[model samples]
Target: MLIPSAQTGLQKALLAIIAAGGVAPAEGADDSYIIEEIRAVGPGCPPGTFDFDAEGQHFVYDEMILWHPDPAGRTVQYTNCLTTIAIDVAEGIQVSVAHARARGHATLDPGIVARHTMKFFFAGDPSGAMSHTELTGPFDDDYDLSGQLSPGGEAWSTCGEPVVLGIDSSLQLNASHNPAGTAELSVDRLDMKIQARRC
Candidate 1:
């Protein structure tokens, strides 16, 4: 993870915390279409809490950043590719974490004011090969995010804020991107219950 040039330890602290937080993009303007944004919730440890010094572990990852200027003077666009390979505190610590990548973009009012949406993508859940963990596919859409879903029940709702599906099951996390373009999605938690475990 690339450390942000934030002033003050507390500011840096919060940025680190939010690095793994599940904050979605807030509402936007009339013509705006959120390509992607922060996750409202998920299971990856807080975004910026990588060092885990308190836990006595350290991990490093790769991040790709692209900056493109648009014709319009109002917004400067950017594309960010985040790739992470984590090393559990195995020798002394025990943390079964996963690697993740987020290749997304944003058109923003740059410099001091950042209005952007950042999407996240897993390499694919470690248990994805299993039948029980139908965690979804590349850009998993098994859980729907858009409020208005198609009645055909093509997929399940995963936006966390659940709707009754006859049975009461807490929602799950699913990743998706625009079929037409890129997007940013914020996920808060991915709670997995592996009762009958399989590799």
Candidate 2:
């Protein structure tokens, strides 16, 4: 009997889930979307921790969830594309589309848009199947930082107060923009708790 490797098994599982129709475009979607969940289990790797090829900007995980917005007003759903999820120990998280069919296609890379001086924390728990993330930066007056967790979840706050939104089984809280675009807001901070399941 031919046994599947751990990586292969995980990939098969992810593909199955994707085929089940979990991915869809968010309502009134835009050009970009954020990562909603990430989960993985493989040999030689911890439950929540996945292998990261820094030079290639590739991430290998058992499973992951992404919030994709359809500019054409289609339904929002999870994606299984080979995307890039980059995180800096001292910096913030950057989710980019490595393929055209994936979410955030043609969108600005969060890493590029994010200010280097920002401070944040991002981590996942395989045991609990959840990820906790937080970040803070200076509010940009030129562009509006408002966003939504899901299709119709809620508008992300640009005020110095914590703005919270629910993405799948995760909760994201952001407080780093000035609605009025007047003061030099501190981009208070954004916190998120994402839950994922092993396939």
Candidate 3:
């Protein structure tokens, strides 16, 4: 999360990014937004394990991991994290999460499978979005999980008011019927694009 001292810097960067998209504001207009609060809960995202980068428009998680360490029997394990962010924006402006990317690593033996699921929505918006990616392997590798949102998938914030955005995610590993397989999956970071435009 960002402190008050960094608010000005974030505002400048955000404004520049928005302007680059051909949505420049009127001269001397200061329609900026700041992250007013962030709350993360779940075993996979404990206190001090998650933070947001205001300038990068991303969230970093240090401890989102799920492991199945036994190679003798079938097992199912899952880890989840839920995060809510409150953003205070200037009047006449609306914001939306235009894109999202997840970076992670996975080590799955033959017959092992893993899946990552995510849900994103605005607090008062009716049309939310859901995305999931699955991986099955016979080896170890790093993976970048990316997906395109459907038309109208972006949930816009209410004009001239603060908005709360929620992100809920989970990682699941299934080693069922695999008598000699082990698996491990870790999600390191979640990157997002916050777009601002006039309402």
Best model per lDDT: 3
Candidate 2 residue-wise lDDT, 118-183, digit = tens:
111111211101122222333223221222222223112222221112111121222223222111
lDDT of 1 at 116: 20
TM-scores of all models? Answer: 0.18, 0.17, 0.77
Best by TM-score: 3
lDDT of 1 by residue, 1-199 (tens): 1111212322233244345643333321211111122221112233553221211112221222222232333232333222222211112222221222222222322121222222221222211110111121223122211111112212222232211111001112222121223222222222221011011
**Relative to the true structure, how large is the alpha-carbon lDDT of every model?**
0.22, 0.23, 0.68
For each of the candidates, the C-alpha root-mean-square deviation to the true structure, in angstroms, is 19.1, 20.1, 11.1
| Local error of candidate 3 at residue 188 (angstroms) | 0.4
Q: How many clashing residue pairs appear in each of the predictions shown?
A: 30, 11, 0
Please provide, for model 3 over 1-199, each residue's C-alpha lDDT reduced to its tens digit, 9 standing for 90 to 100: 1011112322333334333442112121224776655666778888789876643357788999987764444388888877666677888888888778888999998888898877666664555666777888685988876542333356578897877666667899888857467778989998877777888
What overall lDDT, based on C-alpha atoms, would model 3 receive against the true structure? Answer: 0.68
Order by TM-score, highest first: 3, 1, 2
